[model samples]
Target chain A: MKVTILGCYSATPRTFTNPTSQVLEVRNHLFLIDCGEGTQVQLRKYKIKFSRIKHIFISHLHGDHFFGLPGLISTFRLLGRESELHIYGPKGIKEAVTLFLKLGDSWTNYPLIFHELESKDTELLFEDDSVSVSTIPLDHRVYTNGFLFKEKPAPRKLDVKATTKHNIDRSQFNNIKNGANGKTANGVEVANQKLTLDPPNPKSYAFCSDTAYNETILPLIENVDVLYHESTFLESESRLCQKTKHATAKQAAQIAHKAQVGNLILGHYSTRYKSIDLFKEEALEVFPRVALADDGKSFDI
Target chain B: MKVTILGCYSATPRTFTNPTSQVLEVRNHLFLIDCGEGTQVQLRKYKIKFSRIKHIFISHLHGDHFFGLPGLISTFRLLGRESELHIYGPKGIKEAVTLFLKLGDSWTNYPLIFHELESKDTELLFEDDSVSVSTIPLDHRVYTNGFLFKEKPAPRKLDVKATTKHNIDRSQFNNIKNGANGKTANGVEVANQKLTLDPPNPKSYAFCSDTAYNETILPLIENVDVLYHESTFLESESRLCQKTKHATAKQAAQIAHKAQVGNLILGHYSTRYKSIDLFKEEALEVFPRVALADDGKSFDI
Candidate 1:
């Protein structure tokens, strides 16, 4: 799995910074997270294929998070895209987007589906054989939720050397790979453990943004292989963090540490500070495996 | 009066080019027109002061024409703007913008007023003593109207030397500037033209975009000091122009020539064109005084 950061600034777009937006590449699926204003331009700058985005997840209804969605959708239509697009976000998103399309008097040639999220509990939103997604309710000024993407375990691997030594028949190859014992024409029992090995553990990624420090999400994101958390302010602005219901760098690290995430990524820094080294330094105090997220940065999990 | 092109390309925002948007500086107001996607970023790149923009005019509801408005308004709120903002646009614009704000649960501290355009005839949408703006109905895929910003004839210049030679009292300057006959204490009359000369006929500017080749707008924009017209295609692509309800370069210049506009500014080039010089070349065939509008290029009217 690979993740790319298109933008990571708080509040508004600036000359050197942008609002929140990212891309997650997992199991041949490209998922867009929180398309902020200017996101279409950023996608072009990064050379990310526009048609590859089939799923979009919006954390909330803030302009900085989903303002670019309408433009992106319209561009897809202009480009003659025919694939279906699925959008999952809080309630009222469908109405807002529909109003834009209705006012413009232009409709997409492709199928556009919206999955409005209104539940306050963790609920499965998407699932396939290889991966699954669930929402983690977050504490914020408005309806917001963090998304958890978990990869399903792979199929059992065949131990070729062990199978050969055990004299496993060619007809039982499929059964052995499935960790099942198969009988031969001689009526002899073939043990599955002798021909198969355990599958590799799956990885998980969690995206959390525009939320206050809440321990309630720990269970949903616990032990995630990668954790992307918003760090809207530094320590100096800690007081404003609570008032605005935004997370500071230190607070994000505390959540990562408590959740025991493998790696913590901090982003969405405010434009007031020119340097982002302070956020990294503050976050590292709580979680040693913390890294600051920057625009165009890519991470492999 | 000065006009700056923020974006002129038609349809979609590209990596190096932008869609419809412009900044017109008349008197002391910085009027933003037709905010497409990524307009805020373009404004930042051009070093425009967002706060200086007190009014915004949206030509239509097409995504390429006005998708950036909500984001710009949200940014103003985030920046703690306290001044009132006036937006003039077609019907359904107010509800579209209000829906976005309500969904985000974010309200602006500043007063935001929307003047929804519902008239098919030429009507004054915005005006003051120094400048007046009227709508020019155009043929397009949707209900749209172009804007004509005419600078009111400046206060007739008081010819100080002529006034002194005529022995006019300084206290009568106001009456002379207002084109009124000066009444003297001894029942004497002073002709206004003898004391004052007309100020350099106040400049006028007309903006027409996303419209097909139609001569109906000529009368409304006739004899304007400067006219910015959309040329979305070349003569070779004139077929597409008609099919898409857009104008070609030659078509735009034809209107400019027929209307006897002082200067013809051609823009909204299609992305298929490699260079903008072709638009000027094509327009010059019909109108000699034609120039291609480039992003960030400023023109003094």
Candidate 2:
């Protein structure tokens, strides 16, 4: 799995800093998360293929999180896209988008599917053979949900040399990989463990933003390979966090430490701060493996 | 009057090219005209004062003309702006913007007034002591209007030397500048024309975009100081212009020639053209005083 940070600042977009938005590439699918204004330009700047994005996940209805959605959809129509686009966002997303489209008289020729989410508890949102997505309800000023994407375990790898040594037929190799005992051409049984090797561990990623420090989401996101959490302020601004329902860098680090994630990526810094290095310094005090999310930065997990 | 081009290209916003949007400063008032996506960033890039903008005029309901409005308004609230902002646009604009605001639950603390228009004829939209704005109906796929900003005639300038020679008292100079005939201290009638000179001609600016070539607007914007008309295509693409309800560079110059404006500014070029100079070259054939609108360019009228 790979993650690309398109923009990672809080509040309004500035000349050098943008609001919250990112792209997650996992299991042959490109998923867009929280499209802020200027996201299409960022996508073009980063050379990301716009047509590859089939699914979009919006954490909340805040302008910083989803204002670019309508323009993106229109661009797709203008580019003559034919594939269906799926949008998963808060309950009122459909009404807002539909009204804008209706006013412009720009109904798309392609299918636009909206999956309005209203649940306040952790629940499964999407699942396929190679990937599964679940929601982690978060505490915020409004209805919000962080998404967890997990890559499903692959089939066991077949040991070609061991199978050949056992004189197993080529057709039986599929059964061996599927965790079945293989029979040799001479009708001798071969142990499945001897014929196959274990596959690599599956990877997982979790995204959380625009929320305050809450312990309820720890379990849902625990033990993930990578965790991205919004750190809107530093430790000095803890009091402001309480008023704004946002998290400080230290709080995000504590959550990462308790969840035992392999790596913690802190983002969504407030525009008031001139330096982002302070956030990394504060997070490193609580979590050893911490990274900062900057616009146009990419990470592999 | 001065005009700043924020973004002049048409259709979707790109990495290098932006959609339709501009800022017009006339008679001590800053007016935002046609805010497309990424306009806020452009405003920041150009270092334009955001708080100075008191009124916004949207040409139509097209996304390229007004998608950035909701985000801009939200940013105003985020920045703690207290001044009331007035928006004038087509009839459905109120519904579209209100729905987006409701979905985000981000009602502005400051006053937001909407002047929704549904007229097909020329009408006065805004007026103050120093300036007045009128709408010029245009032909397009949707309900559209081009704006005409006219600076009111200023008070006659008192020629200091002439006033002193006429023996006009300083106290009576104000009355003379107000276009009143002043009496000398000796009780002699001093002709206002002898003591005062005419102020520089009040300038006017007209903005027409996303419209087809129509002769009706020529009378409304006749003899304006500067006229900005959409030139979405060149003479070679005249057929495409007819089908899309847009005007070519030649068509825009023809309108300028018929209107006899001081200068013609051609913009809203189609992205298919590699060189924007083609538009200027084509427009110059019909109109001698023509300028092409480029992003970040400013013009004095």
Candidate 3:
């Protein structure tokens, strides 16, 4: 899976900093997460094929998280898109988007399917042959959900050398990979372990933002290949962070460490600090494998 | 009066080109016109003071015309703006904006007043000590209006030297400025022309956009000092322009010439062209002294 960070700053989109938006490219699918203002422009800049994004997941209704939704929808209409677009967002997203389209008298010619989410449970939102998505309940000022994307395990790899030595027939290869033991046409018992090797490990990614330090989400996101957590403040502003229901750098690192993720990505820095180095320094002290997310940066997991 | 063009291109906002947006500064009031996407960033890049903008006028509901409005409102709220903001637009504007705010659950601390407009004839929309604004009905894909900003004639310019020569009493200065015959204590009548001059010609500016080549607005914007009209196409694309309810450069110039305006500014060019010089070249054929507006360019009328 490849993760591209469109923007990472918290609060608002400014002349220099943009709000939250990212793209997760898994297999042939492009999943857009949290489209903030200027997201379409960013997509254009990054040369991302916006029409390929069939699914969009919004964490909440904050301006910084989903303000660019209407513009994106309008752009799709302007471009004459005909494919169905699925949007998974908070409960009121349908009303908001529908009102905009109604007022403008500009509705999409394509199918616009909205799945309103109001529950605070690990509900599956999307699943295909290769991947599945679920929500991770989080603590925030309003209803918000963190997304977990897991790539399903692949079929067991074939031990080519052993299979050749054992004369495993090509037609029986599928059964061997499926861990099925069967007798050969010569009445010889061919064990599946001798014919197939272990498959490559599956990868998973989790996204969390605008939330307080809640331990409940650790288990759902634990052992993921990558975890992106909002680090809106540093330890110096920890008091204000909790009061605002936002997490500090140290708190984000602590969660990542407890979850035992392979790599932790910290983002959504507040504009109060000119330098984001303090966040990296603080997070590194707690979780050594932490990296600060910069706008337009991409991570391969 | 000063008009700053924040953006002038038609259709979607691109990284290199923006959509329609302008700032009309009359006396102490800063009026914003047609906020498209990236307007806030344009405002910041142009160094326009946000707090000074007391009123915003939207010409239509097209995304290219007013997509940036909600973001600007949210930014103002985040910046702690307390003064009321007056938005004048079509009838459905209030519903669209309210729905966005409701979904975000972000209410502004400041008063947001929407003066929804629905009229087929000339209607007064704003007035102050120095200027007044009236709407000019426009023909477009949707209900649209062009704005006419006329500066109330300045207190007739005082011909101080002429007044002194005419021996006008200081107490009668006000009367002379109002084009009245000033009478001295000795019953000597001073001619008004001898004491006062014409009031700086009473400059007026009209903004006409997203409209076809219609003659109905000529009378409303007649003899204005300056006119800013949308010229989405050159003469070569006049047929397509008419189908889209947009004017060609020649058409804009024809309107300006028929209205007998002092200067004509053509804008809202389609991005298909590599340059805007063709618009000016085509417009000048019908009406000389035509200027093509560019993003971040300014015009003083």
Backbone clashes for every candidate come to 0, 0, 0
Give the Cα-based TM-score of candidate 3 against the true structure.
0.94
Output per-candidate TM-scores for chain A, rounded to 2 decimals: 0.96, 0.97, 0.95
Per-residue lDDT of candidate 1, residues B199-256 (tens digit):
7788889999989998999889999989999999999988897678999999999999
Candidate 2 local lDDT, B206-252, one digit each (tens): 99998999999988989999999999999999998877889999999
Which parts of model 2 have CA positions greater than 4 angstroms off?
none
Candidate 1 residue A123 Cα shift, in angstroms, is 0.7
Give the per-residue lDDT of model 3 (tens digit) for B172-285.
777677678876567888778667777676679999998999999989988999999999998888889756899999999999999999999999999889889989998898
Q: After superposition, which runs of candidate 3 have C-alpha atoms over 4 Å from their true positions?
A: A169-187, B160-192
Candidate 2 CAPRI category: high
Winner by lDDT:
2
Taking all chains together, the TM-score of candidate 1 against the true structure is: 0.95
Angstrom error at residue B173, model 3: 6.3
Model 3 chain A: worst 10 consecutive residues (lDDT sum): A176-185
Task: For candidate 2, write residues A115-217 as lDDT tens digits.
Answer: 9999998778788998988888989888999999999998889999999899999998777887999998779899999998888889999999989999999
Rate residue B235 of model 3 by lDDT: 82
Predicted complex 3: DockQ: 0.64
For candidate 2 chain A, which ten residues in a row score worst on lDDT?
A11-20
Number of the top TM-score candidate: 2
Candidate 3, residue B184: CA error in Å? 7.8
